[model samples]
Target: MTQPWKPDRGIRHAVIALGTCGVALVAAGAVLDSLWLLGLGTWCLIIAIGMELIYRP
Candidate 1:
């Protein structure tokens, strides 16, 4: 029997990647004392949240 197809996984992968990068950036920012990087990480985190909500399992 044919199985049901699934949606593309690229978005999910991007979300996960961005999430991990954001976490790493946050840690690096804390260690480096760079507000710009910290802000960038915060934005990345927001994007990750949006991506997750849009692509819920």
Candidate 2:
């Protein structure tokens, strides 16, 4: 017997989360005085790239 192939829900969720987080980080950066939010955005972007690479066939 063989297992059925399935779509990657984890990657999909990760992409959505990354997008939302990125937007929030950018908005916080603009509204706040610290650079931490901007840095967080950069990190989120990096994580997005990594997720893309992992999800790609």
Among these predictions, the greatest lDDT belongs to 1
Root-mean-square deviation of each candidate, in angstroms? 2.4, 3.7
Instruction: Give all candidates' CA lDDT scores.
Output: 0.87, 0.81
Clashes of each: 0, 0
Model 1 poorest 10 in a row by lDDT: 2-11
Error of 2 at 43 (Å): 0.3
Model 2 TM-score, 2 decimals: 0.70
Give per-residue CA lDDT, model 2, range 1-57, as digits (tens): 855854776787888799789878978897896599988987897888788778865
- Segments of candidate 1 deviating more than 4 angstroms: 1-5
Q: Per-residue lDDT tens digits of candidate 1, residues 1-57? A: 855765646788889899999998999899999998899999999999998887775
| Candidate 2 residue pairs in clash (backbone atoms < 3 Å) | none
TM-score for each model: 0.81, 0.70
Judged by whole-model lDDT over C-alpha atoms, candidate 2 comes out at 0.81
